[model samples]
Target: MASTPRSVWHNPVHFLAFGLGSGAAPRAPGTFGTVAAVVIYLLLPVSNPLLYSAILLLSFAVGVWLCGKTARDIGVHDHGGIVWDEFVGYWLTMLMAPPGWFWIVVGFLLFRFFDIIKPWPIRWLDRHVHGGLGIMIDDVLAGLFALVCLQLLAAVI
Candidate 1:
């Protein structure tokens, strides 16, 4: 096992922001990444969908940089461990619906499912794109797909 680094993981907020080093999880880290996001989401004030969306958008916008740096620090390309992408992407997926517990749970699950499965364009983007933007775009597209499915389901019922 690698020795724990000093001054890193010592800061609670940074550690969590890094997804409890879920970014460091050896296998299927993005799934664990989404789980970490779900845990944090449960604690947030999400009574307003728009506000939640704004925050999510901001996270995606900023995620380009943070994910890049974290990947760099970890010496990887689109490393599964760094899940700020998953968090922001999942939040975006949930934004299309009215804020509620049921929808939130479903959104988290759906986003995780799609992200992990990487269907169609999501897979294409992941394979083709590179750099920080690439790190995030596929997940964003996956969230968009999940959002559309959700919106369509809402319309049908």
Candidate 2:
């Protein structure tokens, strides 16, 4: 049930298992976790332009550092169990947009797809960047990708 700390560094399964654990929930843990973060994000009065801007900015800055630190502490790089990038990504994706369940579902799918597919620069960043910021950067790119797609869909629909 538990991975041994001694071998965690060398064990690929342990690292992948730890990272992907976030997706293992009976339901959508990544979506659930992201939505939970949305509640906190919305509670901040970001409905105001200034405050919303701050939350977006601060979350990103903190995300880079915090996610990296957590990854290091866990002895893995961008482990799936660490979904803080999802937290920040969803927070930014939903900002200045409709908060309906439909939008939430759209955001969730887009984020996951982009994260997994890792197109263009997202793939490039994930491969080239190192450390915690590297981990967070790829997700940030995924979030941005989702944001752009969601915005386009909103326009068409």
- The prediction achieving the highest lDDT against the true structure is 1
Q: On residues 15-83, what C-alpha lDDT tens digit does candidate 1 reach at each position?
A: 543567765566767777787877777765577777777788788877887767655665567765567
Please give, for residues 40-153, the per-residue lDDT of candidate 2 as tens digits: 655767568688878778877876776677567666776555566777777667666665778877887888888778899899998999876786788788888888889888
Query: Which residue pairs does candidate 2 place in steric collision?
Result: 19-79, 19-80, 19-81, 68-132
lDDT of each: 0.73, 0.68
- Give Cα distance to truth, residue 3, candidate 2, Å: 4.9
- Every candidate's CA RMSD: 3.3, 5.9
For every model in order, what is the number of clashing pairs? Answer: 1, 4
